[model samples]
Target: MAPVSAPDAALRFVHPDLDRGPEAGLVVAGDGRLALATGMLAIRQSILMLLSTTPGERVRRPDYGCDLHRLVFAPNDETTHGLAMHYVEQAVATWEPRVQVIHIDAHRDPHAEHVMQTELHYRVRRTGIEDSASFGFDLSGGGG
Candidate 1:
């Protein structure tokens, strides 16, 4: 019999492929094997990593990241939020092919003038699973 190809084997299975962050450090599982994220957890991890990375930060894949960091000093107004949303949408669309972006929103924190809260909504293409991720951007120039 011919060898069972990887793609063929994958098609025969129902579980989604395992996910590991490109920059995430190795994690030890309870069983001693490496831990890997799967399903929605994996997708969420990927989204977080993508958002955290800055374009050109990676040596080999210089273009594999979001540019939201560039707006750190931008005015916390509608224009700034619009630019942030554009950056997020473009980054997610360009770097992550597994999910379709539904919406992106950015708003200044009512309590903190130098903080901007961003929320992202996306749907997994293969399973149609929907989820959201939120993070904050610090504009205080504290350099954390």
Candidate 2:
């Protein structure tokens, strides 16, 4: 079944702190109330958090996280590269609904032993602004 499209609405920057995530925005007011992050700030944090999480690490939500951590020990090859790409896409799609991923590239560093780097390109949902982030997973360790 096809999903219904949401009506076109202006992007509203004001919101409660709960939707923004665990950490407060880098900007602050003298009153000390955490200001909600907007534009690139919010998108960057969401991407980082989604990619850093492991599937089983979250309480109650066993399936909540990118599969990058699972590929830490997997043999690095064409198959592994594809799996890493899939993990990034799935995690980003599931966790951060505010942005749509445009491109994802994952490859192993030849000189750096046991390292896989993922480059992500995405656009914000409402604003249509594009940005990129690079993440590295140390295969020597168990996490990304």
What overall lDDT goes with each candidate model? 0.76, 0.72
TM-score of 1: 0.77
Report the number of the highest-lDDT candidate: 1
Residue range 81-117, candidate 1, lDDT tens digits: 8988999999999988889999999999888788888
Off by over 4 Å in 2: 1-37, 142-144
Question: Which window of 10 residues has the lowest lDDT sum in candidate 1?
Answer: 9-18
| TM values, all candidates | 0.77, 0.70
Give the per-residue lDDT of model 2 (tens digit) for 1-144.
Answer: 243233322222322222344544354545674445445766676677668778899999888889887776777677888999998998889888888999999888777767887789999888899998876677767442
Error of 1 at 48 (Å): 1.0
How many collisions between residues are there in candidate 2? 0
